[model samples]
Target: MTRDDLAGMLGEQTTACGPARDALMAGGDFVVWDGPVPAGQLARTYRMRLRRTQRRGQPTLALAATVDRLLEAEEELLRIGQIVAADSSWTFMLFLNAAATEVLACTGVARIGTCPWTWCA
Candidate 1:
């Protein structure tokens, strides 16, 4: 996916993950993890991409703004998955793209209506 596509999927632009996002935006090669792992697991490593964008210091000025935009984009991407995605990959991708564990936790709570931490599995 392109940076704009990821941004659109994530909701807003990122200041930290800018370079990676820019890479994707500019049509750079990317490797998507599309295995059977749950959303939580899938997102663990990918969020680093967002962090890097802020460190790059040009496009996405503040990590907060970048985070805000990413959350919105994630919501949008999940909503879209209600149709196009035949498997968990779509949600997995966004979950992976998310900036923080809190975002994913909130998303899980929204999905299950309970704190995931309280669950045994």
Candidate 2:
């Protein structure tokens, strides 16, 4: 999927530091590698290198937790894809429900205002 597609999936306007977008940029890098035998089951491995920010004071941490949520959401999407392959009648609705469930369950902040990503930005 394209950067726009991933942004839409996450329900956020993909930030400048987004892993998908970074992977597409010139000389940019983002990757997820399989963990070694020892930590394989419990570890979710990912690496992303973003440009250094030149902000005026201490930069607040943002999106670290969100990344984990998105990863879980991705796994849910894969499962839904397999189900859709087997039974296509209710594909659209099933996919939508799966996506919504994943996003809601993984969201760190409570739903009180706008999208939590807005706060991160």
Candidate 3:
């Protein structure tokens, strides 16, 4: 689905995953796609893309640190079955997005991936 479509869907889904949905909206820079695995494929699930918008030399170290901590602390919230992970590809893509992860390694930003627990199955 398109970004606007996803935004509307998110708006309607507040009760489904409020914290995660709110977190994503608060992020201000994210895109929605049908899948994140295999680079380009459609699925019943949704995938979000968050780019590191901060300019270079802006000092993302603190954010990175926080992301790392969250990732460690919220392991259960972020966990998903192999089938879901494989179908969505977001968890893997987020882990593999080295450049983005480099800046967001320790910030609330990483929680964006963990926020959508509804995806778990």
Candidate 4:
């Protein structure tokens, strides 16, 4: 999906630290990788930033949905989640509905298992 599509998916704009978004826009960077291990698909490498201001010094929260990165390498999967969460000062991921994207506070869905990697999908 395109960046605009992703924005619509998450209901926010995505910002990449470098040229990740630009590269993906140019093509070949957002290809889906599928394999037998995870039985899912993932975008190869797409750099993005999603920013939300905190309320009076409160930390901002953002997240990378597990389903979004389901097919990525283990490290990459973790990297995406951390990047989105940490970039927003740990406010991005709320762990609701056991979904990586089911951020806490934002979504009222209760988290199920403790697994942070794959649960929503």
Candidate 5:
């Protein structure tokens, strides 16, 4: 779907905390990726990589830092993309800088079940 489409969808969603759509839109244009791999799988793969790096004592990926911010709500993040499964079982939202170069965070939403993966890069 296009950015405008996604924005409209987000706008329709309501929350007790506030207008999540505003927070989501503040990041500028949204980018959507079409691929064979599902979002959950992608997140799992990235998480595995992160574990490997942590085991080796290497600096974590930027995505990990972004995920930390997501958990802590340290700062408002920019929304950049969305990854939805073909069966509509799950969706993953990608966040990054306004320029859309560096990825800031990725969060997944599951329709039929709970999603356990949230990865960043």
Candidate 6:
């Protein structure tokens, strides 16, 4: 889906967890990977990445929390994507279905140092 389309889906609501919808609205690079990513793969991938980040001494609390949320709602998400700030100061990982009907969850993490995900860099 287009950026504006994703923004429209996020609407004007502010979420208590992760980044607010405004982050996506503010603009950035957006890319989505098509998925139904097996069953537990999504959470597994994030967990592995979080662990790797932890090994390097990067703060991973936000991402870890996000991963937990992903585990809770893993079945509903069919695709995954990210929005990196224009200045590359932060990123928001978006979990949703391919059809773009809903955004199941999102998490924002500061890009204080090298991000494990190259796309966020």
How do the predictions measure up, each by TM-score? 0.26, 0.22, 0.22, 0.20, 0.34, 0.68
Which candidate should be chosen as best, given TM-score against the real structure?
Answer: 6
Sorted on TM-score, highest at the top, how do the candidates line up? 6, 5, 1, 2, 3, 4
Evaluation by TM-score, superior candidate among 1 and 5: 5
RMSD to the true structure for each prediction, in A, is 14.1, 15.3, 15.2, 14.2, 14.3, 3.9
How many pairs in model 3 have backbone atoms within 3 A of each other, for residues 3 or more apart or on separate chains, i.e. clashes?
8
lDDT of 4 by residue, 1-121 (tens): 3444422234323222122222223341222222222213122221122111111222222223323433333333221221122122112221111223321112111122332222221
The Cα RMSD of model 1 versus the native structure comes to: 14.1
Query: In candidate 5, what are the lDDT values of residues 1-121, reduced to their tens digit?
Result: 5444455554221221112234344553335543333334444555575565456454322445434544443344343465454554444456544444444455444333444233321
lDDT of each: 0.30, 0.25, 0.26, 0.25, 0.43, 0.63
Per-model clash counts, in order, read 17, 0, 8, 11, 3, 0
lDDT of 1 at 46: 29
* lDDT tens per residue, model 1, 1-121: 3334454443333323333333344444333333333333223332453444335432222334434444444433221111111221111122343332112221211111221111211
At residue 98, what lDDT does model 1 achieve?
31
Question: Can you write out model 2's per-residue Cα lDDT over 20-63, one digit (the tens) per residue?
Answer: 23233323221222221211111132112111111322222233
lDDT of 4 at 121: 14
Runs in model 2 lying further than 4 Å from the true structure: 1-23, 36-61, 64-121
Name the best candidate (by lDDT).
6
Q: How does residue 91 of candidate 4 score in lDDT? A: 20
Shift of residue 4 alpha carbon in model 3, Å: 4.6
Off by over 4 Å in 3: 1-4, 11-16, 34-121
What local lDDT score does residue 119 receive in model 3, on the 0 to 100 scale?
Answer: 24
TM-score of 4: 0.20
